[model samples]
Target: MSNVVVQPTGITAADVLAVARGTAKVVLDPATVAAMATSRAIVDRIEAAGRPVYGVSTGFGALANTFVAPERRAELQHALIRSHAAGVGAPMPREVVRAMMLLRVRSLALGRSGVRPLLAEALVDLLNHDVTPWVPEHGSLGASGDLAPLAHCALVLLGEGWVLGPAGERVPAAEALRGAGLTPVALAAKEGLALINGTDGMLGMLLLAIHDAAHLFTMADVTAALAIEAMLGSERPFLPELHAIRPHPGQAVSAANIHRLLQHSAVMDSHRDDLAHAVQDAYSMRCAPQVAGAARDTLAFVEQVAARELVSVVDNPVVLPDGRVESTGNFHGAPLGFAADFLAIAAAEVGAIAERRVDRLLDVTRSRDLPAFLSPDAGVNSGLMIAQYTAAGIVAENRRLAAPASVDSLPTSGMQEDHVSMGWAATRKLRTVLDNLTSLLAVELLAAVRGLQLRAPLTPSPAGRAAVAALRDAAGEPGPDVFLAPVMEAAREVVRDPALRTAIEREVGTLG
Candidate 1:
């Protein structure tokens, strides 16, 4: 990967992923340095005038009235970081920490946080050298800008906390810095607050979730198409004219994808004129587009939110270009919180509808002529019966997880920072919801492919056949009874696999 130059605008989700994965390097633009210098001058002028700024000369939170002497200004910054790095819980994933570091650096580079260019450089060096700080998962109320978690990150820059070395071993920050040929950065006025006061943690997770949801939403349509064909369902409902009348962009995209995936399908053509077949299929088959399309639309809205946030400068006591320092509440995480919560609900509904299709495929009565549980022999082998159970279990949990985290706020910071946005919690659970949705869709794919295989002599559509062939190659074709766990896991891998989608897209063009 090449170096990604940090600009005040145009940083993308892919860039964050690349930097987090250690495949890309970050370089600060000269204009960004110039901007930071201008902001730093304002901060310095403010300090020189001896007037109290929220985080410059005065204490923070409930103690904002307390003033510090000029001699202890640096000491105040140091103490703030130390006291705030008090989070508890398991260490956050390495990618999350790296993303947080990158986002913090990006926000500072925008020149609104009043930090020196060297501070931003230190953050970039941390990423380039693969030194990830051990940030905890808890202690952020999503107000006052992920204070505890970010302070832990700042601790590594100060050479005062633990860091994961390039070799993936936990080591002291001092040791890691020395081995990487770097040194600790000393805190200056407002530098500590600049380092810790932003919504980087929540925003990073939200971005990752948005990226994953985009893929999964498209995958949902693909899996639903496979299920529709497997159950011998008709594609008339997906006709262009039928959907054009109620044209929601997402619904139209989904209906078109299903239409394309089911084209030239012998099984569907065989039942097109048959009077014995039910006139209309169940809602699970007919309404797949409506449910999945709503999710696609939700994802589009969430992406917009994430895009706006990517270019925003979130900080407390932001420095103005006119040499004036003012306190602001841009650090609140409500925007991200609401978006995360909405996506979780949308993802859960997608999984719910997919689970319903899985149920239709497994039930012998509802599955047209397919065997019970899609098994070769019903009672002897419990083929995929429990798979639906697993999918159902996951969907149930997703429903619970979908409850909005933003609605439950608890006061923090001595009641000075009340009405916090539990966005960290929201995004954290959103990851789980996405993971569960992947598995749920995989179960649906497994059942549908088995149904299609049973439909044997009659061929499925080109795209559906390609998906089944890819799955069979990866996980082997389903049979009577065998070890179910590995097979199901392999199927899940195929469902989550980008290559499967790529192969199908090559055959029938790209899906929605």
Candidate 2:
């Protein structure tokens, strides 16, 4: 793909992903550069006149009243970056740092942060050359932007911190800059604050999580369909007419996906006329759409929040086109915080429901005659009983993680930043929840596919068969249990594999 030309108002979630994944390059639009120069001129006029600006001549936060001499103005910007670059713990993933860099550049390119075009271009150069800063996972309260984390990012531009080279080795920022044929730029008035004061860290993680969650939501439906067919459950509950009366768009989409996946199934037809079969399946089977669909709807709302954030100027002291510099609470991360926490709740519930289905599939009593844990050699081999335990453990952890981090706030910066969003913490945990959900769904898919394989001469729907075939191709057929960890891990990989979804789609067409 060609480099993504970032216009002030047109950065999308996809653009962020492309840059994060290293598939596309980024360039600031010429018009954006011109606007930024205009903003920078306003800052220079203010500084030259020795007029007090919040982040220019005056101190930050509670220190806003303190005045500084003209000679010390550049030192103030540099000091702010060095003092705030105090994040601790393990570094954030390289992809996340790349997204943060891309977003910070995008925010500056909007022409409201009063940063020179050179600073913004330097950020773009860092990304384009693949020199990722090693930002720690902690330090931001998510109130005054992702201060510490973003400072770690800005440290690299000043040739002070460490960066991951293109070959994935850690090197000094100076070395990385020299290798990339780039030089560090000096910080001007309010430029350091502009770089660090925003919700870019949390927002970056949120965007990436949103992207992954979109796919996982669909994968949840696909795996649930396999479980339903594997257990001989009726597809009648998923019929469009049955869902039309309720009329939730997400529910309807999920139901339609399930219906399509089970079309013309010999396994389902075999039980169609049996009165001895239970009149209806359990909630895990019958209510799969309701649970998974709620997640889908939650994702849609999160996407809307993310989309608005993409175009927003989240700086602290924003420079307006009319030349007014105002200190505002636009830097607070409450918006992203709430969205991340909300999505974590939705994701945990999705995994919880999938775990229940996995439990049912393993229990001989509840599974409608599938062998205990799908084990042909019952007593001698434990089969997939432990896999349910693993999923259950992860589901329990997810429940704990679902508690809203946004609600837990503590005072900082001498009570000036007393109420923080804790949004960075929220988004961090959301990434974990997503990872757990992926593994949990993989476990459910593995057990369900095994149950389907045991069903023998009765064929699943063409879509269902295609899904099973995809899993078998990736992990081989399930049989008398051997070392199952490798198989389960392989199954997890298959769940994440796009090809598996594509193969199923070729048979049943597109799913929701």
Best by lDDT: 2
lDDT of 1 by residue, 398-503 (tens): 9999999999999976889988999889999999999999999889888888888889889988877877787776556657687778877888888777988898
Per-model TM against the reference: 0.97, 0.98
Model 1 worst lDDT run, 10 consecutive residues: 471-480
Question: Candidate 2 residues 123-220, lDDT tens each?
Answer: 99888888889888889999898999999999999998888765656689898889889898799899999999999999999999998898898999
Cα RMSD of all models vs. native, in order, equals 1.4, 1.2
Instruction: Give me the runs in candidate 1 sitting further than 4 Å from their true place.
Output: 165-169
Clashes of each: 0, 0
Give the true-structure RMSD of model 2: 1.2
Provide the global lDDT of candidate 2 against the true structure. Answer: 0.90
